[model samples]
Target chain A: GAGVSQSPSNKVTEKGKDVELRCDPISGHTALYWYRQSLGQGLEFLIYFQGNSAPDKSGLPSDRFSAERTGGSVSTLTIQRTQQEDSAVYLCASSSRGGVGADTQYFGPGTRLTVL
Target chain B: AQSVTQLDSQVPVFEEAPVELRCNYSSSVSVYLFWYVQYPNQGLQLLLKYLSGSTLVKGINGFEAEFNKSQTSFHLRKPSVHISDTAEYFCAVSAPGNTGFQKLVFGTGTRLLVSP
Candidate 1:
């Protein structure tokens, strides 16, 4: 079976530019999430989608960060006016659940975004 | 809010040596614990999880983790590791049920280097 996957394995962009990272979760996964990993830093929570809805956006670092999941299948993380601080590996994950304990979340390869 | 800490950034070991990666998490509510492995150029793979029941959980590749509620720790240990075991390990925590919505708070990660 296909596992979670992400696009643009690596991305290089100028500061202040915008970038959109895509993720395709495992088939039938109803929950999608985004996270950031910076050098020497732990994985930072971003945002998540359950089914076609989003109940938690608190992890989003700033107003420029946003994410959406449509049809309860795929998800996209859009970083507006990207900054050097936003340079990191953007990882996506999905789960076969609407609730947490119902299923385990699977991760994707991740899109590495480098903002100059 | 929840946070995770991995005390070690890197651990180099000879093949067949025993290894331990420490992880600590802080949260106000009861949470589900997980350990994930990431090989080079790949996404995270679930190694093990502790939702309920036994405190000691076994996972693939001869890996195991002990969940200490009093210590709020989920430490990964592997005895007699293999060269193939070289990779990055991440510890994560998430609240259970709908509030979890698959959201995870992850540790910085511990890189395991198993050499022959």
Candidate 2:
């Protein structure tokens, strides 16, 4: 039904400024993911989208992190200057299919991001 | 390039007295396994997956997981656990089929404290 959906459950940036986190998946789920859960990279895997773009950003960890998914669905993860270790808790997921070899993902209700 | 290793970040049981949450993965090929559960604040919810033909996979509340192909591992058990099963727990790996857009590889979460 209506499962995946992510927004500003919580965001408090400041370290360097620049923050944007959002996700909305589940309408048809075409594979979408972005993970981050502090406590020393306990939930890494930073970018993924199959309909809009993104082949596999390599779990992005450098370049301040980045993400995008427009027409196919909705996904955004921009952390530019922010750092304080980038805070934590930023998750989003969606799946119905994911071609390389795997499927079964459904998550949302995250966006802690607190880089004070 | 697939990897998943959730070797317990936290596990303190008591409620029922039988719990095991340990997942391991390192793809050489063929992949698709999952077990998601997040309670406090909410997000992930899969709880069970093995894809193939029974390797001992059962999920939802009662919990159960076992897909050990040569010991690649996909362990998540629950003989007697409650207290809402505490919280956090994730172990993912993907790359199967369809086009929904698969790309999952999570492991670095395990926080289940079911005390009495």
- Top model number, lDDT: 1
lDDT string, candidate 1, A13-101, tens digits? 99999898999989988778887888856687677787878787777889999888888887888999999989899888888774665
Candidate 2 DockQ category? acceptable
- Model 1 chain B: weakest 10-residue lDDT segment is B95-104
lDDT of 2 by residue, B1-116 (tens): 67888877899989989989989999878788988888998788888888788899888889999899899999999899988889989888875322344566678888999889
How large is the i-RMS for each model, in angstroms? 2.9, 10.1
Which candidate gets the maximum TM-score versus the true structure?
1
DockQ of each: 0.59, 0.25
In candidate 1, stretches whose alpha carbon ends up further than 4 angstroms from where it belongs are B96-102
Tens digits of per-residue lDDT for model 2, A54-76: 77777788888888898889888
TM-score of each: 0.92, 0.34
